[model samples]
Target: MLKDNYGRRFYYLRLSVTDICNFRCNYCLPDGYQCGESIAREKPLSVAEVNTVVRAFASLGTEKVRFTGGEPSLRKDLVQLIETAVNVDGIRRVAITTNGYRLASQIDAWQRAGLDQLNVSVDSLDPQRFRAITGHDKLANVLRGIDRALELGVSTKVNSVLLREHNLAGFEQFLDWVKVTPVSLRFIELMRTGDNRDFFASNHVAGRDIEKWLLHTGWELLPRGRDAGPAKEYTHPDYIGRIGLIMPYSRDFCAGCNRLRMSAQGALHLCLFAEAGIDLRSAIASGDHRDLAALIRSAVCGKSAGHQLDRGFTGATRNLAMLGG
Candidate 1:
């Protein structure tokens, strides 16, 4: 297994196929943000390159691979990429985190290509509030996609970013909606990252308070024994689905960190709050698999003890979109 300096075994890889997104969520992208000249000129790693990186990680005991993007569904070759990752020798699961705008049309193709899981970002069930949060009027489209995913027998989950001023009041309503769905709901605490610092300052909600409310509302907290993600999960006897809280700022789950992040540009990130990363693109381009593996090991071994966000640390300089949130 790939063991970091802190003795954490890294087995999950979150790979970003592209940094280009369709929606401009206020918490993720800055206001008035647009795909500009730099974005146009930027080239993400090729499918072959991504396969090579995945092979290296699998060889080092990586078992799960998740494709992320500004919107992974935007990629024309996503099905092929999923096929490549899932067919890798040691890779057991391949998944994607998408906005779900294009998911309905492509769900069949993705399932046939061996996608094991899907996480859709659905912040609000109310139509107007959904558009207000995502800067798009496709709430119905997203809901359709979610329904299709469930019908297709795909293991699905719904993610919502908790903004104190925007979505806090809708928490109970969100729970009400979840009661009728079969997919789990995860509420993510907004991270204080670049470009959204001011918004985060005003809208960041503590996961602890959310937990208290859930407990008071009769949701049963459940222990996630070996799951690798950051969320603390819960379930209610009366509901068909579960609820989760991911508190990156209000609480630290770094001690159980088990994944590494790879940017679309091929930078290997050891932590979500890491300031910088080691470039594996260059090593891959050199056609030296041994060298590339060594670089990956070096990067993991150099991971910091923990993200110091609680100690007044903001977050990575790159925004969530750039970092493939």
Candidate 2:
């Protein structure tokens, strides 16, 4: 397994298939995709290249591989990518995090393609509120997609970004919906990225508030999975579903970091908030698996203990969409 200098061992891999999202989310990308002109001639990693990357990680004992993106569903060969990861020898779980645009329509096909889990971004319960937040009026359809995933017995999760004075007031509504649904309802704290500094100041809601509320309301804090993302999950006896908080600013947030990320263009991101990255595109494209594996090991060895978010340095991450949610 890949171990960092801080005694943290990596077992999960989050790979971006593309950085081209269609959502103009108020928090992340309010004006839709803005770098189309700059990247118009740039092509995302091909299917074979993605396979090479996944195989290299697997060789290094990476057990979980998650396909993320500006919107992973936007990529035409996303299902193929999932299938490829599923076939990797050491990869135990193959998942995808998407916006659920084609979920309701293509979920069955995806299930057949060997997808083990799914995480969809559904920022709001109310269709109108959802529309206002995401700039899309398809909450109903997205809900349908969630329903289909549930009906198919797929492990489904819903992620919402808690924005101050915007959808924070709808926590109760989220509670009501999750009371019976079996999916995991996660609220990600609005983080201060390179470009969202002003917006973060105006709307950044501390996740601790919600964590306190959950404990006060008889919710039981659950233990974190070995290879799970940074979400402190909670469950209630009465509720069928569970709640989770992905609070980047929380104390000791990065102490348990066990995952590594790679951009669509093949740059290794030590942390989401790390300065740019170490490029492995050439090695990955060269089809030299041994060289790529060596590079991954060397990169993880130099991993820092934590991010410097408390000091107000956002690093090379101008926007979350540039990497993927």
Candidate 3:
């Protein structure tokens, strides 16, 4: 098994399927953004190539896998990739994180392909605000997608990135939105990544702030234990699903971190804000799957006890879209 310095076994792997996305969210792009240029020259690993690496990870005791992207739904062959990973030796859970614009159409096919869970990036309940944040006015489409996933009984989670002025006012509104629906709501503290600092300051809202807010609503919040990917979870006693907080800034869960991330093009990132990555593309393409797997194991073995960025973390503006949330 791949073990980190903190003695946590690295069992979960997040693989980004592609770097292309339909929506250009402000947090993901710079001010006055333009999106015509293609990074196709960067060369993303083929689906089979990805699956081969996954099989190696499975051999090393990985039990869960997550598919992500600039928007994973943008990948047409996503279902095939999902099916392949699910059949890997030790993979028991397979999930996808998408922007939810296309979930309504792909839900049935994806469920049949063995997708175990879904995390949709949805920030605001207000249509206009969502349009401003994501640069897409298709709020109706995403809303329908959430409804469809719930109707099919998929284990769905709605990921809301809480920025200072952006969607802060809608925090309670989001809670109410989940109250009316079956999807669990997660409050993701917006990390200082991309050109995010340009649009807004890094607002470090503690998980207790969320807990305090929920307490005022008289909806008793109880710790429901930790979920995957650094999100400490809680559930309203009267609510059906849970409320989660991903406080990478205010609180670091590096001690309990049990995951590794693979970039869209094939770099193995030991930490989310790492300055460099271990190259696995060349090893995989050389038909040395074991070497590529060893690289992953070694990367995990070197995972820093924790990142120093929590105190004064300011991200480099050039991180690829697929790397961070």
Candidate 4:
């Protein structure tokens, strides 16, 4: 089994298939930037190329894969890529992190392709606020998409990044939305990435604040059960679903770290806050599976205990869009 400096088994891989997205979320990219024009020159990896990279990591004991992008569902061949990864020998679970706007139409196709779960990014329920945050007024579309996914029996989760002045006050309403459906709600702390430092400095919300908010709602947060991501989960009294909190900045889970990432163009990231990455595309293009597998092992070994964002270690300067966070 491959392990990082934390001694936790590093088996999760978050792969980005594209860097271009339809919406310009304030936290994810530069404000008002043109999507297609600002994208990098390199084309996204083909399904076969992504499959090769998945095989290399699976050979070294990687077990779970999460497809992400500026918006992964935006990829025309997303289902093919998901199917390819699922068929890999050691891959046990497959998931995707999306903006939730395209899900109403694509959920059925995605489920048919063997997708295991989903994490939809929904910043605010209010239409005007949502427009301000995402630079689009598609809040109604996203909500309908969520309802459609829940109705179709797909395991869904709502991902709400807690930004201080923006929508932190509406967190309880988000939790209430999750309580009615089978979807799990995850409140993530805002990390310093891209131009986030310039727009909002005090927007970083911690896990403790979430826990306290849950208390006022007469819910009891269950204790930590497994070594999943940084999110600490809680259960509401008599409620069917649960809530999760990811405090990457306030409370670091560095010692229990167990994940790695792959950029859209095919660089493997050992840590989300990493400034540099190892090129897996070059080895794959050479058509040497053995060399590619060796490179993956080396990359895992180089995985940091946790990102420096937690330690006030802010050396990484890459935008979250490029990093596929």
Per-model root-mean-square deviation over C-alphas: 1.8, 1.1, 2.6, 2.3
Largest lDDT belongs to which candidate? 2
lDDT of 3: 0.75
* Candidate 1 Cα lDDT to native: 0.84
lDDT of 2 by residue, 9-60 (tens): 8889999888888898988888888775445545778999988999999888
Task: State the lDDT of candidate 1 residue by residue for 94-133, as single tens digits.
Answer: 9999998898889889999999799999988888888899
Which 10-residue span in candidate 4 carries the lowest summed lDDT?
A: 310-319
Task: List per-prediction Cα lDDT, in the order shown.
Answer: 0.84, 0.88, 0.75, 0.77
Can you give the lDDT of residue 216 in candidate 1?
96
Which residue pairs in candidate 4 collide?
none
Over 1-325, each residue of candidate 4 has an lDDT whose tens digit, in order, gives 6665556676888898987677788777646445565455678888888888788778878888889887898899999999999999999888889988798889889988998778889889888888888988888988888888777777788888888888977866776676676777888877786356765467776777667878887877666533255677778766778888887765456766777788888888777877677777788777665688887776676676567775555445446666567
Arrange candidates by TM-score, descending: 2, 1, 4, 3
Per-residue lDDT of model 3, residues 139-248, tens digit only: 88888887887787778998887777778888778776766677778888766654555554655455668767766866554543223666766666666777777777
Task: Mark the regions of model 4 whose C-alpha exceeds 4 Å error after superposition.
Answer: 30-40, 215-227, 310-312
Better of 1 and 2 by lDDT: 2
Candidate 1, run of 10 with poorest lDDT: 32-41
True-vs-predicted CA distance for residue 214, candidate 2, Å = 0.9
- As for TM-score, the candidate ahead, 1 or 3, is 1
